[model samples]
Target: MPATSYLRRLCACLALGLLVGCRPEPAKPLDQQLYVWQRQWRPAHEQALAESRADFSTLRVLALQAQPQAGWSRALVDLSRLKADGRPVIAVVRLDGQLPALDLDVARTQIGQMLADWQAAGLNPSGLEIDHDSASARLAGYTDFLLKLREQLPPGLKLSITALPAWLDSPQLPALLRAVDSSVLQVHAVSNPRLGLFDPVQARKWAERWSHVTERPFYLALPAYGMALLPDTGGVPLVESETPLNRGGERRELLADPQQLADLGHQLRDKPPAHLAGLIWFRLPLPGDRRAWSLTTLAAVARGDALSGRWLVELSSQDGLYDISLVNVGNLDQALPPRVELSAEQCDGVDGLSGYTLQALPQHLVFNRQSSARVAAGGRRALGWARCIRIDQGAWHVYP
Candidate 1:
């Protein structure tokens, strides 16, 4: 027991304590917001907004839009249904991409009237978000338009814009960023429709680059919906979202995976970029929204909760006819099964709908999925009907 041994042990203990003290704490969870893109608010919105309150804290409601020669169209938002409590609300002004020019006079008139209408409804919007997809070459003109619009806005009212990554290459980007109090960098449906709906890797890269350009706080607008591609004679497919075109042809669906978005959010929060404030999920989902995520699934993703999916085959019978449907009884969204099989004593007049084809064999009927389809959490998908004396519900199976 010498003095030298005691000194060595004391020095080792002090070093270990320093190492533990220097370890950084975990990052805080990012804020969550929603884009209420529905032009016509329904009674269902009451329930949706109430359920979303526990997770999301902001609402970017679509207020009005301008067409090429159609002047302006205002959304039929029921102010009473939009009881967002104390959450911040931002009114979004959409400018159609087909417009040949940016008309500040029209914008001033349109936005002023829209704001007055909102005030009449007792909606005190905290900000104005200009949703435009101006070309990269037009950033200079866009910046000028923003500056002019900012002057017309009420004093102390915040101004923001929906930005695209294509503008990242523009030399006048910094000036454009300076014209707004904030920006929402949209990373979905910014490219060719054939490529895909969204790419998390590209989204991350865009956010990192955007952080390097603007000093103002910003948020990322991620997709929580799907789009359908309809075949056209011009070789280019027409993209449909939230609205259905009554054209009669097989359409391919492109959905933004919820799991992918959840993972991206986790990564961004783990190591947030400079001035990156929060996440704004595109197109808040309604109960009957076919191309959007369910409220249960979306809420789980925003809270970074665990995901587990359970799909069950359900059969409803009426007069020797059995209707087959896939029910998602779990809290996780899942891809539709590639194949569905049903055992029956005898079935006739078999058919399939909603992206499936029916194949009838001796004692089993196979519903083969021909395109990509997704089943939302706590949702159902029809797989056609069967005319049989008995449908063996206990023997049905679904194959991925």
Candidate 2:
């Protein structure tokens, strides 16, 4: 081999090595990546503010007020405070344990008083949520009791409930859900302190179950406080050593530092389950409480909304001419490659479908199956077909 030729080949090999090194490393999985860091306190708080201002009409904050205690009353007062602070919506009480099977007269009187107190405090909402662990056979009687109570509720006030994931497998579950205007499924894993943070693996599985069970609108209840299941003499939840803690104990106290909350918001944003109307934190207390969760923590979870600029876009329809209009569903927009294969619900060649196809207007971006059409706004109004999907009948997403 000639000396000059040998040197040239060596340089070419070195250049190829440099190109491979310069290419960015493949992105890390979310759970493996270092959490986003906050450079200054101001931005962290501003992030908190941005979350407060984001549109969460689909979200509902569950404020647990069981029976009548100063804590419950205080929680109700705080509901008005948060509502005034611009929080979109909230659920006044959380019902867990065996309360659902209680006689209606007892439950109704207690609930009515809570509603009366909420109204007195200038926090009037017709929707009341009852949250409980799943007991399928008992749900029938529970639904009947709720229907009776609904008849007596202030007209237009809705009744809602929080369900356990196991209910999804139960044949009676859908009927139970039908009794209310909406339902929230608590998706966190319940574990013993010795076991560690709620198992993300199990949590994901349950999230999928609830998502499939409740095909209609529903919210996802996230864990703000961690629970340690005590040793039970038999198959029941033990409370002798009941202490609600989070993933990292004091170090990972979720609601205390803005960053920790942001981390949670980050986790949620990365892996949002389906039919997720919005996120809910466990409980709320006075602005700051170390042991008990507070409105601040709830606010912190709300703060995660800043990352929610996500929209699921799909090419919904294609006319005989093969022109396609991409449909954007949910609040966030999805970035997809041009002219690729996508799921059918995502974009169909027919109106009211979702997927992507390479084509130009006169195109329509129909938001949902029902709406006639929406005007294409990013200035390429060549007029194929443009439309907005409605989450329901009246709500429409603004398109660019």
Candidate 3:
């Protein structure tokens, strides 16, 4: 080959290499944060907020509720008591869809009044977020309402909306996005029992699709809370309220698994979309809220830690019978074994509870068919009592 031809080939190869090297890498995963939705106002929540403030960039507070007849009902959140520690706060106002027709003027007036009231009380919020799950047919009305509300907001105050997944492909979504500073896509909700809440696969697809269509940055909201459902005679699961019911029914709980959240974190870290701002938890964790994730579990999940199950077996004596309680002391949910056998020299027979089936063996009590014994993290369940010939000190072994 001639010297000129060889030089040209070398130069072309160098240029191609340079172009490949200069190409930008995929974006990193967004930071994860919390959303405070508890309105009862407890000191423990305040402490948790103070301690975990470093993990979050902003705190979202529930400030108002839009009603049909009354217009807007102010939620009893004591803004003065919530210490932000210099972090910005976004006041979240929820809309109850009880009105047959939405009045844009009424919404604007109520929002303006609430903002002014906050200003008067010496609370300066950095943003205002509207939480409304609008149907596809009502997207136009919802967009118009948001536009009017945005006009009345104080200058320099950012506006945001909590968006439903079903409305992502609607043509009116562009109009609504244009009217707000940012939109939060809530990926966790309990509309069906079979699918459970927080389908990670579906959520990832939605995030990818939204990123391609929108230029505005958005946050992906994940769940840290669980739901308790009770099946009626018709076999439909009904959500249980905080109040106790007079009727007897079987209860089942759906918890947000830490492993699932950690897996999602890993996926996002590898190839997070460009338009994703970060992740926002549905609500902050409280120690007393059994349905919500614990602070330790949340931190571990955010750090992309793989969780393992740990069980603690405790034996208690009541009415001349030995009761065994299986407690999940770890930060992950565990599936109860199909059959659990306890071997003890002094045990004769065992009695089954509502959650498990019991069988008597030669020298052990076999607990079988435990289909409903799923225990949440930090939850405890009694494994029924064992009937013995007499009470005496003896060694016990558990077999899976």
Tell me, by lDDT, which candidate is best: 1
Note the Cα lDDT for every prediction shown. Answer: 0.89, 0.47, 0.75
* Total clashing pairs in model 1: 0
Q: Could you estimate the TM-score for every candidate? A: 0.84, 0.48, 0.74
Task: Give per-residue lDDT, candidate 3, residue 99.
Answer: 59
| Each model's backbone clash number | 0, 31, 0
Query: lDDT by residue for model 2 over 147-208, one digit each (tens)?
Result: 88788888888777877776766787777777888777665544444445445556567766
Q: CA lDDT of 220 in candidate 3?
A: 89
The TM-score leader among the candidates is 1
Worst 10 residues of 3 by lDDT: 390-399
Q: Which digits, one per residue and each the tens of the lDDT, describe model 3 over residues 1-400? A: 9999999999999999999999998667577767888756667766778766767777888888876776667777666766445577788888875657666777777778887887787778899998887887898988888887787788999999998878876988888788888889888872477578678888898888877766798988998767777878887777653334466677777777777778987888888876788888867776666567767667667767678777776677766578877777887766675666666546665777747777766666766655654566677877777877543334333345
Candidate number with the higher lDDT (1 or 2): 1
Order by lDDT, highest first: 1, 3, 2
lDDT of 2 at 149: 79
Q: Model 1 reaches what TM-score against the true structure?
A: 0.84
What lDDT tens digits, residue by residue, belong to model 1 across residues 1-400?
Answer: 8999999999999999999999997786788999999989888888888888989989999999988988689998887667445688999999987789999998899899989888887888899999999999888999999999999999989999999999999999999999999999999999999999999999999999999999999999999899999999899999988988878887888989888998998899889999999999987898768899888888888888877898788989899988888899988888888998888877777899889998888889899999876687888999998788888888988896
